[model samples]
Target: MDKAMQKVNERLTPEGKMDVLSKWEVHTLLTASKERFSYEFRACSLAVLNTGSTEDNAKAVLEQYPDFKIEVIQQERGIKLQVSNAPAQAFVDGEMITGIKEHLFSVLRDIVFVGNEIETNPRFDLEKTEDITNAIFHILRNAKALQTEVLPNIAVCWGGHSINRIEYEYTKEVGYQLGLRYLNVCTGCGPGAMKGPMKGANIAHAKQRITDGRYIGITEPGIIAAESPNPIVNELIILPDIEKRLEAFVRMGHGVIVFPGGPGTAEEILYLLGILLHPKNKEVPFPMILTGPKSSEDYFKQIHHFIESTLGFEAQQKYKIIIDDPALVAREMRSMIEDVSDYRRSTSDAYYYNWILHIDKEFQLPFIPSHENMSQLELHKDQETHLLAANLRRAFSGIVAGNVKEEGILSIEENGKFQISGDEEIMTPLDKLLSAFVEQKRMKLPGSEYIPCYEIVKPRNLS
Candidate 1:
């Protein structure tokens, strides 16, 4: 079979996890793969099957394999996937790669479970913040992400998938140091920074003869096609939405290390900052460090300036900044994590999840990145700093959607750039920071020119 034109057909059985499903679960999955929910399920399945892709364009990937089809067939023994026209790259000697097969079943498991148990069930009142948090907890618990007896050793790394070589290498160095200390890694589970950390940690774990090091990758539907799970992700999870994905990262990880990135990274930074700055979370011992290689010194400077100018110095004090030193970054985070563990033990909070953290409804509710919402964002200093951070985070989230998500890309193509207007005080610094990202070529995958999907404007009242 020609690698380009020849498509392989196969029946894949779950080899690792999620092998068994109830009759109802299997029926729901079968329905989801049909016409009603076909697009969502197919898109996610395609992403899982097309792992190792370097291209970040979701639309292009789908178009490239227009004939690809996946069906959930109920068998006498169990459920099996009937996949036709899948990417030839996913196969080795005509057999689907073992890891990709596992991921495909995991996607089926999550989509069916979430659709039936969370979306359609009346018990989960997503309107209530606590209920929403409970739903997230249940999802993670169902995935077996929360291990109560385990110490707090997971470090969530956030950065741009379109990072430079230097920045990517720095992320690996930090991950190596973290692994040397027996810390596991959790990332958004895509390329560049996300892949680098896991790659580095795997080697460190091997060196230490640690067989069970976890490389957890948490993502969502909207962004999954573009940022498909990197092969290094041993534990893959698909959250219902980006908001839940962000929450899962904070809840599941012991600490966070942010590297130089674009708007997505900025959005993650703001999300955590908003949560940490909440009055109720004042005493929480969450460790957050922003670090990068020497070339990224100015990068962190711009980020620091932006945060300070917008959220004030109090938010600035919430996280530490270390430049050009990966070893120290890991050591400092490890030490701070000790404090986190002690706090959790003292407060009777589980080491696996940060149950005591107060996440307001504002942070929990999903923010639709529509043009009107972007235009009406309250990016002024009138509200509490945390509230302001939430809005700012939404602003960046819109940019992220416009940059990579398929819906946002189509919206931009049809409606033109999203209009984002706010107080000049905020807009000025925000614009500067965004401009720096584009100028640094951090907006899109390397060699692909970035077209601005959002136009920053002055507030109407001020104008």
Candidate 2:
């Protein structure tokens, strides 16, 4: 821990959205670290207080401030949070930053609600796919994420948290253009590409006098500590897992714009492609764009080549690649999403959520990236292309876990790197694509050398 990273003590009452809590809710929030839900709520709370941290490693961040503690105190009128040894950056002079405070309470809000209402309630049957989708809808509805009056304007941006200065600037430019068109921005809500768009959109919203510009950040507990909620996020929702988070993005946003990123970005692309490839969703008018700066053309090219090699040209046809033109990216998205609006209107689907999109249960189920499970992934081309994309999505997802997630990193430490073996056809392209990510420094931030967490293996021919 740097000695300069000061700690502060404060007791705060929730303001704005999360001002009140029941005694039972307050008790659950207070005892988060000691119960069935594990230490996630506590860890996420700490992450909220440590916003603006440049460090990407979750384990390192937690170890650095081992003494930090947060407690929820119940009151007759409401509840209060007592935080000790919180990172001083969340404060100015002696008061906590208003956004950080709101985020902290939001963490508490989601954790408690998920634990009580979704997990334990008998009304929700998690085993059923429809029930899972219902749970997500309820969670978003509870958080006020769904707005009935608003037209389709939410654009979900996917990209790497570790990006170069040029790419980061390009993201902001694209974001600025989107905001000028009165489009709201939603992202993973971390640093690098995730934060860049929100930051840029804020300025444009200010210029256009758009007061209620929504900057929604959706994340899951497993990766939240690594990618803490950036300060610009006015609406932050923590889904139960990565699969649910991906589903939430697809179901909520009208369109998607993918920026240059590492395996995590690949995971998102594969996930979306898998959903789109399903025969049920083939006609769904979901606008997809892959855009970045001129320097990033090769990055998109490698991604495109990999997709062509594995999923074929039809999968490649699902999205368009536009490099070095932020204004064009925004204009194209604006024009394309109108088609989305028209489709929904014609089908009588809700504007706020995409109920018409059919996602297979395979994509909805959470995949634990344990070594055995990772090694068992069917990376061969024998399966349906959509199913293959799901497996490929899981492969990239496991890599992302090993790269920045604490448990995955520790697992790699305990038992070497994850062994990913597949047909030569897949391994060759997969290895080449991952090599490009490392070469471009997309695996980790600029200063750190990224040690790979998975090894690509090509199986030998059997005579």
Candidate 3:
């Protein structure tokens, strides 16, 4: 369909979601379309429409469709979205695709809720650590993500969106194995590894005669534009920011299975490790596994090297490296999740959320990936190990933003690449791991040239 033919102007009601959306909740969208909230809502909406976009540049997509607009109109029945200048791909035969429509409402539901209920309400103090977690609980609860009836089955999968066929297929097989064991899948809700596992598990769920398979995709505003919600994401949730998004994954997931990915994936690993390394959470049976095809073995090795060298052996112990065995990976994850179930049951913790685990305020607070913030990150070994992991997670997060997020990319253009300086011991391996990602085309889609968005500077005394 031509660009003009693709321009959709329609009034759409909710499908499989938010059919009874409150006027006070979603109306925040129409009112929020003024400043920061407007940008986030519009950007996320466009990202949902650009579902299959190959170009992972958020700014480029916004520029491509400058006229896109959405409005929330309330009625006695519920809220209906009047969207115009929407991408044609989101619709089929003049009707919006059911999945895309569902995702669109999810964005509307979340963006407005955070802007209106969570952020604006005096009850939620986002600055305080406990309050932040409480806000996340409310957000997830609002999304109907917290189900008390089910046991621990949600496996949060993390991997790159630009993965090769081998790695992608491996994710699918692993997911299929998980599905045969009646496990559900959750991810960043994008493509590549995220889509692979869900696709694999979907077929397995079918074969096993299971109909209620949950494919939960959790994302935030910053990353959504570049990594749009893939079609397989039956349940799409938009957290207000990346920090909450990461916390949501850990809070809700019973286990984590990581596939080969780039900086963003590494950022996720660091975030999870930072939390697991805390003294208060040592006994928590939150299983984590890293697996990939044999060819992608080196990728996992590089990740292991980065973690061990920077955060020490303790961080390395937090996860297992399982190579090329989908069945074993699934078996291991399923078995471990049972232990998590027992731990939760015994502790009187909610089955839907991990309430006992402690996340430091350092990790709970949002980090702006600005040039100054990126340069000033404390990447040395002087601080606590978990603190160091938190800083390292910030570094990788900045690179991810530079690589895809619209504001980060534009900032890179206006100011320049981010400069990262730390001790030589950490700098060498850090630079090497990033270089390997570049060479492997894990930083971006294959064949798209990558310009280093950040420079790793060694301590002046050593280099």
Worst 10 residues of 3 by lDDT: 21-30
Which tens-of-lDDT digit does each residue in 316-405 have in candidate 2? 999999999999999999999999999999999999999999989899999999999999999889889999999999999999899888
In the range 1-463, model 1's lDDT, one tens digit per residue, is 5565457889988776657777877777777668455787888888888787777888877888899999888887668889999998888899998888878877876776565578777889998988888888988888888987888999999999999998898899899999999999999999999999999999999999999999999999888987899998989988888899999999889899999889999999999999999999999989999999999999999999999999999999999999999899999999999999999999999998898999988988899998888888898888999999999999999999999888889888988899998788899999999999999999998999889999987654555
TM-score of each: 0.97, 0.97, 0.97
Candidate 2, backbone clash total: 0
Q: Residue 396 in candidate 1 has what lDDT?
A: 94
Task: Give the alpha-carbon lDDT of every model.
Answer: 0.89, 0.89, 0.90
Which 10 residues in a row give candidate 2 its minimum summed lDDT? 29-38
Assess candidate 1 and give its TM-score to the true structure: 0.97
Q: Report per-prediction Cα RMSD to one decimal.
A: 1.4, 1.5, 1.7
lDDT of 3 by residue, 1-463 (tens): 6653368778898866777655665456557655547778888998998999887888988998999998777778777888998988888888999999899888877886555778678989999999999999998998898998789999999999999999999999999999999999999999999999999999999999999899999999989987899999999999988999999999999999999999999999999999999999999888999999999988998999888899999999999999999999999999999999999999999889999999999999999999999999887888999999999999999999999999999999999999998888778889999999999999998768999899987564444
lDDT for model 3:
0.90
Give Cα distance to truth, residue 55, candidate 1, Å: 1.6
Residue 115 miss distance in model 3 (angstroms): 2.8
